[model samples]
Every structure is written in C-alpha cells, then in structure tokens.
Target: MSNRMRIGALLGASMAFAFSMAAHAAAPAGGLGATHYNLSSLKSDGHYDRFIVTWRPGSAERANPSLMRQSMGAALSRAGLVRATLSAQGMMQAPVQASYGRRLAIGADVLRTSRKLDRNEAAALMAQIASDPAVLHVAPDVLRHAVRDIAAPASLRPSAFKPSDTEFRQYQWDLKAPSGRATAFGDRNYGGAHVNAAWDLADGKGIVIAVLDTGITTHVDVNTKLAGAGYDFITDAFLSGRKNDGRIPGGWDPGDWTTGRPWQSMCTDEFNPPQPSSWHGTHVASTVGAERTNNGIGLAGIAYRARVLPIRVLGHCGGYDSDISDAIIWAAGGHVDGVPDNTHPAQVINLSLGGYGQCTADDPMGQAIALANKRGAVVVVAAGNDNDNAKYFSPASCPGTVTVAATGITSRRAYYSNYGRTVDLAAPGGGIYAGDRSSGEQVSDGFVWQAINSGATKPVADDSNYAGYAGTSQATPHVSGTVALMQAARLARGLKPLTPAAVLDILQRTAATPKVAPDHRIGAGILDAYAAVNMAINSGGTTSQATLLGNGVALSDLSGAKGSRTVYRIDVPEGAGKLSLRTSGGSGDVTLYVNRGTPATAEDYHCRSAHAGTSESVVLDHPAAGSWFVTVVGRTGYRGVSLVGKYLASR
Candidate 1:
C-alpha cells in the first residue's frame, strides 16, 4: 500500500518546544494596515491555511524554535475573530493550534494553522503576524497546481527523418515543424517547437536540466543513466506522501491524486473536481530528455542525451513557495541545510508550477531565482494557466526568469495561458479545443503528448504510458529542453556555458514568428529549437552582448538603471532610402546611438539622439546597408521604454 495521505489530513508537528524566551511583541494598534502583507494575492486565492514567515537575520525567531513558536502563537491569539472584508456572511478566526512546518533554505519558516481560513480571515491573521517587528515577511503558502489540463490525441502526417519512437509520426505533432498542414482535427499542426531539426545538431549531451515539479515516476522513455542525485524537497509528510516528515533522497512522485473526502474538501472548487495523479513531472522530464527515442518504443525528447535532475517540489494539494524556493537553490548547486549538496548542478531549471501572486524582488522565490541565475542556471517558468496577465503570478513574474507562454497547434496563444510582457517566448502547450480558442468543444490531438503512468491514484503495474495534456506547464519544458540542447551544442564547440541572460537573448532572438498574431502579449515569438541551437553553436558565449533585431514590431518595456547600456542590431536591406529608429513611452531619460556595420557606443556612433525622457529617435537617409547597431544608454533609471525600427522605401 502507498503512504499517500489525504490532502490537509496530516496532523501538525508536535509543539513540544519550551516557551520561556521573550518573543517579539505585536505592533501597536493601527500599524498593521501599513505593513506589506500581500493582501491582493490573499484576496485572490480566497482560501489559505498555512503561511510562510521570514524573520530578520539576527532575530531570535530565526535562531530559536521556542521563540519562533511563542511569537507566532501569540500573534495568532491576538488576531482574534473578525468578519470577512469581501463577504459579510463569512467569518474569520485565528487557529487555536498553531505549529511549525519546516525552515526553508532561504531562512523562511513555514507555519501551519489548525484549519483553512477564508482569504479575509487569513489576511487578518497575516496582519497580526506582520505586526511583529522581527517578522520580515509573511505570506500564505499558497498551493500551486500543475499548470496542465488533460485532453485526447490527434492525427498527423510524417515529418522529414521521423524518429523511430512509436508515437512520433502520428501523435507527437508538438515536436514537428510548422507545416501549416490541416490535421484530422480542425486546427493545423503548425505550433511545434521544431525540435526535430535541432536533434540533428545536438542531443543535449553534457547538459543537466532540473525539473522542479511533482517529480518523476518510473518511465521507460525517460533516461536515468546520467541522472543526478535527485531529492524530494517536499518537507510536509502529508504532501510528500512519505512516512517521514523531512526531505528525503530520490525525486519520486508518490502520486498527487486529490481524491475522496478530506482532499476533495480542501483542493476542489466549483469548476475543479478532485483530480487524479497527473504524473506531471514525468511528462515534463520526458519532454526535456526522454532517452528512449529512435528505439521504436515511445516518443522523442527535446534533449535525449542530457541528464534530467528530477527535484520534487509540488505534492498533494499543491506545493508551498518555501519548498519550491529551496528546491530552486538546491537544484542550481546552492547549499541547503540538511540536504546534501547537489553534485550535478543543472544548467537549466524548469519550474512548471506557480501560485497566485506578484513576485517581488524581495520575495523568497524571487531571490532564489536571482541566485540561481547568478549560479549560471537558466530558470524557465510557466506563465501560469490563469489565462490572465502573467505579471500577477509568482516566479512567472519574477525577475531573471525566462517565463514561457503556451501556444496551440495553430500557433495561437493557448486559451488558458497567462500572457503579458513578462513572458519571454511561446511553445507548443497544445490547444485542447477546435479553433484553439476559448469555449469550444474539446478535440483530439489538441494536447502535448508524452509519457505518463496508467494509475489514476498511484503507481500502477505499467509505467510506460503516453497521454496528452495542455498548459504552460507543458510549454515550459519545451524551452528548458531546448536550452539543454543549446548549452550542449555550445559546450561541444569548446565554448563556455551561456549565462542565463545570454540564453534568454539567444532564445528570443532566434524564436520563430507566430503564424497568427497572438490575442494577448505572449513573448518575442514561438521557440525555434534549430535556430536557437545554431545560434548557440556559433556565438562565442556572448549571446546577450549584442542581440539581433528586425522591423514591423517594437521591443516593449525595455528598462535599465542609470549608466546601463543595452545594444541591438538590425540589418538594413540594399537600396533602402531611410533607416528610422525611435524610442518612446515609459519614464526617465535615455540616449539612442546608431552606428553602421559595427556595435554602437556613446563615443563612436554615426548618429545619436539624447532626450530628457524616453522619447528619442535617429533617422539616417540613404543609410548604408549591412548591420546597424543601436544602443540605448540610460541617463536616469528608465522603464517601459519601447524601441521600434522601420526601413522606408527608396525614393
């Protein structure tokens, strides 16, 4: 029998610590409202039972469990009962029994309440907790689910040099190139990441990708030969579905099926019912590097030769940001307490799960991502499945992350994909409907197909199974896996690994333009694995130093602090009369420099435009052909700056 417990069914840890130390007292009355408690996210999730609290570095709460428990319990009692702000009929009460969950790698503590509370009640309790001067930050441990939704399969024609994997030709439309060919379903199979072409160049040798999700189960297609020493980062015993409470070795999915009474009561909503175990990590991991390709068995992986370091973060009823934050750091070779140091540091970290919240620079997950980027790991995150602006989602909106949006087979933004300027690019997340639009009947072959387990609730006899699921969750791995191939190709040429920023630049620069205009702002374009790998092989590990640009669209929301410089290059066609470059919108002062055939700098440029604010332009009549480099130098800290280029017809 499996050790899986129902969601929210596990009892809190023993509160046996002595409470003799003097804890930080609550703030004076009327000061609670002034604190930053993430009220917007709290109001959106609508239900929260557990909260994560980060204490000041030198505070007693960070050093002593007794002091931490005392301070938190006292704050809970002080909050008392209150009426819900959004609903008059709803009541909010503090938990009678409060307990410590686990300390995170980022030095945050997870605190659990006796039961779930409404958003307003949780807000009130959060206000009380934030009132303490020692408390640096406190936010709900909002549960983040797998961003994918299930669907059926579709028919597809053969691509050039099809893999021997049984499902490659017919069902794996996501891996093929955009043929614009009509499928058995209404939509054409044109939204693939074009991984088939990239396969001939690089198979992700010598690269490691970490999948931070529900973890990997047994799969024949997924390669474990070069696997790293993975870990299950889920600290909660109930969530881990293990007997022990603390983290354990081995990143195995013990099943995240939220079925039956208690789990149903906790995880279900009006539109959502109790879900079966998704085997999300398995499918995601396979997409990155399922090695059983060309063996006449399953399906092809984007990076078949690369190592996948499966790190379990999400579990039953979703995972906490605290667990996820630690997982991100650990996967990128950062040290975490108690957990062994990762011997195999991943070059790419894929986060296919996230919760409702804007990720601030100070947020634990945000800091963790920044650190991961500093460690040279490209962090790829899902743009979320909320079908709203990705800026409102954690990690997706986090700085230094390559947030990915979802596209259907027809290359349209998936109906359920979150889109915004935060998204870096789009991938085949599969549209589960007729027209790849919202509110249509579900169709076959509308989901990204990959390996999965047959069991509905837990691991079953057969593990080599394939199914289709759709979401930005599925789209994210396409990018992560492609990054592995790019890095592997770069390394094969004796070049140093591309930095996170460099990787993003290459990806955005080489991405394929969408066949149809996106309904919302997704990103630069659809991921082109071949172009990305080719660019990686050619560039000398300085991909972001000078990015390539084109006309017809503006690069929006460009921002930089004072004295920072960002450069781009656009090729002018022969016989062009004028090359017009413009920068407008947003705030603060900036200068634009244009140079022909070389990188532009302040001292050496053919033309320059300096404005007090963002409005700046440079026009060169009878402009010389070849590469024209445009540089943007910040006079003051600027944001939301849009840069556009246009080549006029010759007179």
Candidate 2:
C-alpha cells in the first residue's frame, strides 16, 4: 500500500445560507434595514415574497379567522403592495395582495406576497407588515440548505482493524482514539472523538435521534426498520418537488437538484452554481446510528442501536424557517395541527443545517427550540461552515442548543468551522489536509468516511455507496450520536434519562483536552466519548443549574504559583447590558480568559487579556448570557490577588 493515499474528494457541505453567495455582487441594502430579517444570508439576486408572522398571544389575529384576514389586508394596504395576486407568468400584478400560507407549530403563520421580492423590497415589505400591532415578529421566509459537504470522486483501500465493519479499518478514522504513534499512514490524528472506547459502555439502545435535513435515501448499511415513521415538511409546491402544497407522509429524498428553469433564475447565480441532490440526510443518519454496524458490510455508526427518525426539511434549493421550525417541534413530539403527532419522540435531535442570523427566544426558531427543550430533547446543531463566528448563525446561536464546532484529525479546529463564544464542543469534521498545516495537497485521512448514495442527480437504491465528507455537518452527528450513547447508558441502569443540561455538562466535563491549539475557541475541547459515556452511567439522576457568582462581589486574597490556573464561573442571564471582570491590587503577572457555556482556557476563550500585571481587565458590551467561566492563569508566582465581577442589567 502507498504511504500516501487519496480516498475521496471534498463534498460541499450544504449551508443554511449558501456560502457561495459571499462571492456575488453586493445584495441590495433595503431601506431602514431589518429588525427580524437576516439580509446577510440572501444572495445578491435572491428573491422571496413570503414572510412568517407570529401574532401576539392575546391578539385578535391569533384568535379569530376573520380578524386575521382583516389585519393582513390592512398591513398590505399600508405597504402599498395592493397587488396580492400573481400574473400567469408568475409576475406580480397590480392591487397588491397578501394571503395566509400555513400555520406553524410555534403559533406563527406564513404570509405570502403578490410575487417574489429582492432583498430591499422584501425588507421594506416585512417592515411594513411588522408595524402591525398584532404582529409580534415578522421576517422573510428564507431558504435553508443542508450543512453538507461537496462530493469528491475516489476509491477505498483495505485496512486491518477491529469491528466487523469492512470500512472500519481504513476509512473510519474518526471513530478511533487519538494516537501519536507513527505508521505507514503517517502520525495518527490526535483529534479523533474516541467513539470506539464508548462502545463498551453503550450503543444508544432505547433512544431515538431525529435528523432534520434533505431526507433519507436507501442504503444497505442503514436500517430504517427501527426508525420512526417520518414526515416531509416542505410546504411550497415548487420547492417541495412534489408539485403539491403542504407537507406529506414520508421523509424521502426525491432529489433536490437545481439545474434548470425558474429555480436557477431566482435561487442560483454566478457564485451559486447549479448542483445535484446531495444524499445529505442519509449520510447524517448513518453517522448517528447505522443499523448493520459490526455486521461486516460497510462502516460503523456512533450509536448503532439508537433509532434514527428522518424528518425532511430541505428540498429543491433549501427549506424555509417556517417549515424547519415546525419540524423541530414535531420531532420533539410537540403538537402541530394537520400533521399527526410524532409517536417516536427523539431523545436527541441533530440539526446539520443552519442559516446566517442571531436567534432569540421570541423568534420562530427560538420558540421552537424552547418547546423542544421543554419536551426533554437535546437539540444539537452544527456551528456552520462559513468560518465565521457561530453567534452569527441561527439555531447555533439559539439558546438551549448544544452548538458544536468541527475539528480535524489533529484535533485542531477545522479551517472552515465557525468559532466564537457560543460553541459548546468540538468533534471530527475532517480537515481535507493530512496535517493541521495549510498549503499542501489533500489526503484521504482528512475526510470522515460514511455511507452515501453514488447517484449525482437522484437515488440509486440498494447500492452500497460510501464517501468521505468534511464539514460541521459531519462533526455535528458525532456529538448527537454520543448523546444517544450517554442517554442510553443511563436508561440501561433503570434510571431516568439525563436532562439536556446534564448531557451538555457531562460532555463538556469529560471532553479530552485538545492535543494542539486550534486557531480559535472551538469549545471546551474535542469530545471524549468514553469519558462522557462513563460519566453518564455514574451520574446521579437529578440535574441542576450551575452556581452563579454574586454581582459586584469580590474574592479577596487569591494566590497561585507560576503556570497555575484558577477558574470561576458566573451566570449571566439573557439581556445583560455589560459584564466586567478585573484583577487588581495583586503582585503577579496573570492572564485572563473568559468564555460562555464552558470553562475558559488559553486554547478556547472568547475574550482574553494579558497586560503585564494583575491590574488587567476584560469587558464585554452586551455579552451573551449563560455560564461565563473566567480563568486566571499565573504567568509568574505572586500573592494577595483580588478578583471581582460586575454586571450592568439591561434597562
């Protein structure tokens, strides 16, 4: 065998907002900008005429059908969009019209305009509609695509490893423990999630994981027998590819190719190239829990015994937040009118999809997540492939979600993985580069191998197709699968499942320290599956919130030796105005590191200060609230240091 081998090509990870749009001409800056709309995710020429509106709880629009129609009509009239109907050519006609589309599970309604509007036009229209007193929130119904990878053509080689799965030896590098020993394949990656060690503790039995993406396809390595009877949530007739409006019965991928006609005219541009249907949902599902894992055929799954529930939310170009939000609630067993209730509620929900925007508890996505969390489902989301801060992405930024960033084989943050204060942890997302270093030819060890369809435009049933993919889309499943294992391990002991908060805490607490520093703060560290599973098995059944440091309180007379580190945590509630942490009157050179959700470290922190003495300060304006961990590292030995935390409540 050759010392260096190329396994497969890079698959484009489908983004909630197509990263390709960044290369296009500047999109129109709508008047007065937007309060709820995420214009940054739209393409220069992208068009949309639909808006999702959530009515105030006690508003007449939310209670009476007649009043709701009147309210919508008044808003359209004020916006000068009297042309509510479209011409035969699908063009906007005079006498602006607006109509109700569908009701969302989050108590929001989808509103369609006369025709598609560009960025500026959509913003103006949405703003006008939002001005209505009954409308609590209104934003364009932007499409969201799979956070999947682009496919590269290649062949697999033989290898020697344990487990009956044929691909486990050579291709499945992500499942094994990190190693430093050199071999013909080169130095082993120090970043593997260590899933193999977790297998001894649990295989995710009696747990259900729901994957929200492009939908599932036929693959021999994947067993859907234990899966829930899934549903398709795309509502547009053209986008659904079903030619019928409203959601359907099964979650099947009938190809989401955008190569021809109006789709290309409206959704695609020079930067956004036309492409084939990516078997994104299938790949994600396989990673979570492949049915025939150790049976000696293809690859292995993280939680092989966990039931996977496939819920289709992406189709054609992408999907709408309106549809995706509803799917989120339904996947967690929440009620959605018109659709039958989910019989197999997922213990964990994997969202390998995201869009550009910050989310809040009031937004459709946020509301849905709150419901999911209430139902005891841990929502795991990809940090995004844009290489930007995860805070700029939806769902990932949404509170209560376990936001995950990607890491390469070396445990370094994947070059394309989003980084910021919001990330929860890191997992194997594939680097495409053999080593962490950039500027080199790609190698096979950089990709995460899994089951996928070979068909470019459509499904090729029963074909044992597999490929190497890279993206936060791939990294997210690793965590979701591990969550299944942890949950199952607890259940096997005749104990109640761990709460979402407890699961996150255990995963963060047990994560392995990164072998090397990533360019940014990806999270607490690379996930340690074995440690996490073990901790889950041993933890008490009850879960509680972490302790909060007192506001304006000071810890006096603290001291540490050289290179020693001390950590303190503070709880910052949502809507905080300012957060300040400072060390003064101490005779030592120390560095300060702070991050939300997990303990702060030199390798992973959102804010840091190193200014010669103990009189250093770190201040954040409108910081995101959660558990903010502050670390004081002794650069040189000293004593009599005092640390104080001051917070300004939002007025």
Per-residue alpha-carbon lDDT of candidate 2 for residues 151-270, written as tens digits (9 for 90 to 100) = 433533344223345457667778888875442357476888889999999999999999998888887778776344899988887877776788888777777777766576756655
Per-residue lDDT of candidate 1, residues 163-236 (tens digit):
34545766677888888876544457778888999998999989889999887777655675533379988887
* Root-mean-square deviation of Cα positions for candidate 2 versus the true structure, in angstroms: 7.7
Any runs in candidate 2 off by more than 4 Å, and if so which? 1-44, 83-95, 155-166, 182-184, 226-228, 260-266, 541-651
Candidate 1 clashes between residue pairs 3 or more apart in a chain or in different chains: 153-444, 153-445, 154-445
Best by TM-score: 2
TM-score of each: 0.76, 0.79
Model 2: per-residue Cα lDDT at residue 25: 31
Clash count per candidate: 3, 21
Report every candidate's CA lDDT. 0.75, 0.76
Model 1 segments more than 4 A misplaced: 1-36, 81-98, 153-166, 181-187, 226-228, 439-441, 541-651
